[model samples]
Target: MIRKLYVIITTSAALGNALSLTNQTKFKRSPVGGIVTVRAGYAQTPFPEWLTEFTGLTEWPGIDPPYIPMDFIDFSKVPDYKSYPQGVCGVNPRESCSFDCDKCVEPDDVYTCSKLSQTFDDGPSPATEKLLESLDHPTTFFNLGINIVNFPDTYKKILDAGHLVGTHTWSHPFMPSLTNEQIVAQLEWSIWAMNATGNHYPKWFRPPYGAIDNRVRAISRMFGLQAVLWDHDTMDWQLIAEDSNLRTEEQVYHDVQLWKRGKRGLILEHDGSEKTVNVGINVSKLIGDDQLTVAQCVGGIDYIHQYAQK
Candidate 1:
């Protein structure tokens, strides 16, 4: 059985403010286009659990709550594989490999340039606006589909601020374990969710945990997304989520040191943690002028796909 609760926000300004606030309150549009706010405190459920429920996968064993893989993904809904052309091995068509191809030297497989691309993954969070406000330059946000649906207002704010948005998959799954059809579903659902919120589809995709293979890249190409990997990883997610021994302030210095060494490429960080937010604010002192979005770093290759009419 499902229980439904709604809190109506009568004004657009109020709705915007409510959405922009923290992720404490969940908002969704009603069938008649009314604003419905659902207080997230009711069940004390973590965001991942809520995501599992939102994606309709509550009953799967061991795969409950935080586990991303589930039986809910319907392969039949994905596009027919024959509809797209086959991928080449190590050339124009990157072939699927069993191992992590992020270190591949192929030009097409790599996403580096002369300038440093500031990129954040797993966001559209309550902390996103604060991070954006702290930076004088634009950054790239690789968002999850579940986060987009849960926080549409935050997602809209990210786009409105002129930051480049990309797909980080729907549930932040490890791509290697998923079938090709499942990979397609992850990318498709993310793109669809982003389209539903902001009427824009992303042109770049960063695999969660930097976990990608030839198959993942091929599926990404099928959806018209270029795979972007990071050169410098701050390990902010480990520090925050896993309580690693690395201190946040130390990581900030480490990031600055990398910048000081003239290591210019895609720098990876997460917007989901407060530690990362601090790093983003302080790193500006070092690479503020050098910071560029993934698109800008790559010579402004049209990364925006106009899928929605807006």
Candidate 2:
């Protein structure tokens, strides 16, 4: 009887310790006010291809999965505004239109900037400070609203270091799947959160997962924000957090090299992973001395609005 009781107690203690360890390692809630949970280790995706499919839902060339569920906004419901009278139609008038208009002109979807722009996404994490310290030059940080709220100090540090801060959205949802109102809400909430942190509202916004379209760009302009896309994707986000065989450090370098080829523009890296941070520390070697901010690369448009003015 004593042996049986001892076994029960021992089992209970083991289970309790196991649960404690799981809780400790699974998720670490941010100290500030937000739902950003930093996990201890990489959460590997089961089928890596699923991530590609999930992000590319809008542009899936093949037939989508049966009963693919999505909730898109009826853009027709949004009222339209005529182009400003002073707007320049285009150089030839028959091919394209100039974007320098008062009205919500189509966002200039910049692929390659004339100069190299170092940009990181999904950040303002604890790893961010390390990244900033390692870099000899400033880089643009496209921060999530949740992370900015949870780690305002980190966001401020990025700005204090003279790095540009851009919105990466509140919850990091695929923008194309959201309603026009939902999309604007994401940007507005992020801008407000950053402003609340005593930083200027970010004028540039990067759509999560690189999923965006004309409608998304139009709505972004409604909030006086511009959509910034990447010319080179380092795939650093997948280096350690994915189940694919391409999750090695070598793969990251290879991907960056392949994307660079002989072009200079906005290069995408993430500051959310330690592995990525390491990559960022050495990124300058690949891109050379042309590191620039988004605004600088995009012709020095004002990409930050002071909160006090708003």
Candidate 3:
């Protein structure tokens, strides 16, 4: 899961202490309204690949503060699956699509709504670039991973294109298994890399494999990052099913079922692998037919907050 990006504003520790310390990004009144000042840490560099692979044990920041919304935008206001569980597409017979599970059905097939929602993860890859180009409709939210260096130039293109860039660690490691120091290095290095290349701090983080424990949550707060997880999972990660040569139709069937069961707000996916990318691209097409937009289609996480508020 790649976290979203934001500007980091640093202030001295003395200044930081004067206010009722709330978070790394301190929220204060500035006469006009409330202001949040984000802190910048020293650049931590390239971590070993093994540290980030699991993503279950990723660590948080050393700073102690409650995590607050870095972006002022709210998403609760936007129309989404929460408001329309049947989704834009409503129910259809099992034979209509390949799967027989109720969860796999698109909301539009069963409901009355006009707005669409989409959110993608593990991107800035070669496939992502191709997908971006091939998109007949633009993506609503692109939660991109920063740890994978194989596609640095590809990431640069993504940033240059104005998509939301987030931290996925330097190597997509699990957050739970890593020590505090290891976690910090993974996150900080990714941040440094993103800053060096794109000049921003990530605002949101999704634990790799969507795994987050109390310690992980604590670290997220210290860094002023909201731990973001998804309501929908397509399970596009499984490239092959039971058969070696063929994709797993049964598992894909299960994904649709799960999606139907948990309809709304944040759809987890990937762009690092070819199969996932293929499914994601296909999913986007389905979304368009149902009058939904991917998260990037609507304005990314900032918009998600807004949509959620209403």
Candidate 4:
């Protein structure tokens, strides 16, 4: 890594700098209307610290990756794969890993507010302004890089609103299905996006689809990102559809009502769409102002390591 840094003085760090981007708009729409982030001033030689592939040309780079392997990844941080004959964990992770990473929810970590905590994922979407306006209490936003680039102004508003921000990967992909380098690319690109736009190196990460394992956890930890899992799932993304899988706003509230008290819930929600945003607003109202952001619930002063600090 040191050698790679020496070899490329103008590393991807330049790519990360807001000053280097000549384009006023972070991205542009292609003829087909697909969002393509302008790669101007991007490093010709990728820093060992950043992505070797998946440079955010498209919205979902990791969704259908060629699974290219790279030499730059720190293999020492990765753990050996193991089978969970209990079931296919990739299909149902709650039963397999069931790893709850929120600190205040656990007893060992220093205690803070025991209030019910909610986390919004797959956002800083188009509805971010409404969602930010709707919440009296701060919450954690596990945002995707695609959304962050697509909605840069709204994405910046998250920190301005006093909400904790974390990476939800560049493109929301099933982690276990990806190669180790692919996993690294996904994580590093997300980190790059956060740092470039927000000047934040997020300490928290939520694996999209809960598709994490020992290997995934190890890789993320090496990059200083802790993987967080939720206890209660609102399944609010279903609101975008009119199918049998759809969970109505009323049903979501009813489920929340059934949740037991005193045990702080790391509830899953979204700000990714109009429907989910409305449901999140209503849920915030129903749950009242007692709720806390994920970091506050975990006794954390802040969840990001600022670039200025580094």
Q: Which has the greatest TM-score?
A: 4
lDDT of 1 at 251: 47
Cα error of candidate 4 at position 57, Å: 9.8
lDDT of each: 0.58, 0.58, 0.42, 0.60
Give lDDT tens digits, candidate 4, residues 147-233.
566567777789888888888887776676666777887887777677767777888888775556666776777777766666576
Off by over 4 Å in 4: 1-73, 82-87, 90-113, 242-245, 260-263
- Model 3's TM-score against the true structure: 0.51
Task: Please identify model 3 stretches exceeding 4 Å from their true place.
Answer: 1-116, 136-149, 240-263, 289-310
Cα lDDT over the full model 2: 0.58
List ranges where model 2 is wrong by over 4 Å.
1-35, 38-107, 258-263, 302-304, 308-310
RMSD of each: 15.7, 20.5, 19.3, 14.2
* Candidate 3 C-alpha lDDT tens digits along 115-152: 43345566555566666664554333333333234345
Model 1 global lDDT (CA atoms, 0 to 1): 0.58
Error of 3 at 212 (Å): 0.8
Tens digits of per-residue lDDT for model 2 on 173-248?
Answer: 6555555566666776666567667447678888765555455666666667777776566656544542334346
- Model 1: weakest 10-residue lDDT segment is 26-35
Between candidates 1 and 2, the TM-score winner: 1
